[model samples]
Target: MQKTFKLLLVILTYFSASSCDDLFEYHPNQIRLDSDERNLTATNLERLQKQQPGDTLRLIVMGDTQRFYDDAVDFVKSANSRFQDIDFVIHQGDISDFGMTQEHKWVQDILKDLKWPYLTVVGNHDLLANGSKVYQQMYGPLNYSFTYGHTKFVMVDTNGREYSFNGKVPDINWLAKELAPQQGEVWQQAIVVSHVPPYDADFDRKLEASYHHALAQSNMVSLSLFGHIHNWNTDYLYDNKILYHGTTTVKNRGFTYLKVWEGGYDIRRIAY
Candidate 1:
């Protein structure tokens, strides 16, 4: 009886120690991460590129997960179970509430369960002190683009307030170049995704005109997606033809489903 009791206690102690290893992190801002956790944007993009091509591009565009761990998990579950046909997922930013690397990791831990490849843009909160570095380390560049099917996704950083309204957060020049058709680029349309919409106060006022100008010049921009206010809003901001979609946070328990083809697209909201 004495030997059995000692063995049981040893087993319990070992399990407890192992469990708490991930519970208490070395630091909130620590950059510690496994090789598999780094450059998640690139990782998922590679996965997306390898999949069989389809005519219509179907994807989920959502954001502002922040500290909502439970909701994020449920969102993934609902997405996987209900939208098995989706090609990929888009997280609009604010992966961390306090801009802590740990918070980003926690959200990533939950988002990893998603059945489809996912990508993320940066938000104002994600641009906080040292947060940008952490975000870049975990995800790839702040402003980037990818093409799948008939659409080109322009994921850019538009968190202007985080840069003190410097009139450069949106990078209008880059946006123009990204939106325009490249010589061999076969995409029929462009979709812009960012954390802040151009009409928002958080976006740089000086660059708003230039930003819209870039989209208009492309002649192929289908829609603009944003997530920062934690509330869903949509309308044709400047031009009746260009629709801007603002998605609520994951804590609100909802997301947007986007389907696109050569000349047109559809947007739907799903609550789980």
Candidate 2:
């Protein structure tokens, strides 16, 4: 009887320890950066200097990297080595599981090590509490647009309503004006980057309606890029356009590589 009791206690102790280990597993946040890390460097900036006209630009895209901070770091490092000649980077948001300040700092710390320019759009998890303010202060403005290689890249604030208004980013009015074609432009293509996609069921219905219409009407748009679904995917929204859905960092443990020429682009996933 004493031997039986002792064996039971040993089993219980072992199980308890295992449970604790599982409970204390790594939980990645935005601010948990490496101790030796600093922000982006001059060399990194130099690497992103504007490309000459007509050059084939290479950019990399990453899906939801909110959790798995170490995985995110590893992903970037692996991608850097493989895509040594990349021009720019774009993260599809959810850099944090809770959009907390610490999570943002952590991810940024890892990101600053990249030898290329990078951009991040907001994700659902990134808009939790005062996330927008933290994101703006740490990163930059939302709903901003830039041009590269005859391609117009629009970063829309899809989580605008997360604060108090509608999650309807890409302000229909502003986007309408931005999407308006400029005279003398030939063979223009646009890429829309957003956190929540128009087809996401949990997103605001009214906002989705307005934004979907706006995107469809944006005649120059060639692709809509999003990452909330956490899977490798592509959808044909229009005859001339396709929506590229990126996979989550935790799911596929990979990122997407993009090769863009003057008129078209090719994207593929690179797993670690």
lDDT of 2 at 35: 32
- Quote each prediction's TM-score: 0.91, 0.75
Looking at model 2, report the run of 10 residues with the lowest lDDT sum. Answer: 35-44
lDDT of 1 by residue, 1-272 (tens): 99999999998898787855376678777787777789999999999999976888888988898888888988989898898788999999988888888788788888888988999999888878788888889998989999888788999999888989988889998999888887987888899998988988989999888888888788988688999989899889898878898988999999999888888888898898
Candidate 2 wrong stretches, greater than 4 Å: 1-54, 160-170, 183-187, 238-240
Q: Report the Cα RMSD per candidate.
A: 3.1, 9.0
1-272 per-residue lDDT for model 2 (tens digits): 99999999998898887745233435432333333322332233344555553567788888577767888788777877776787788888888887777676667778877777787777767777766666665665666676766777777766644645455454778776677777875437778888777666645656766776676687777677877777776777434455655555644787778877765778787778
* lDDT for each candidate structure: 0.88, 0.69
Query: lDDT (0-100) at residue 224 of candidate 1?
Result: 86
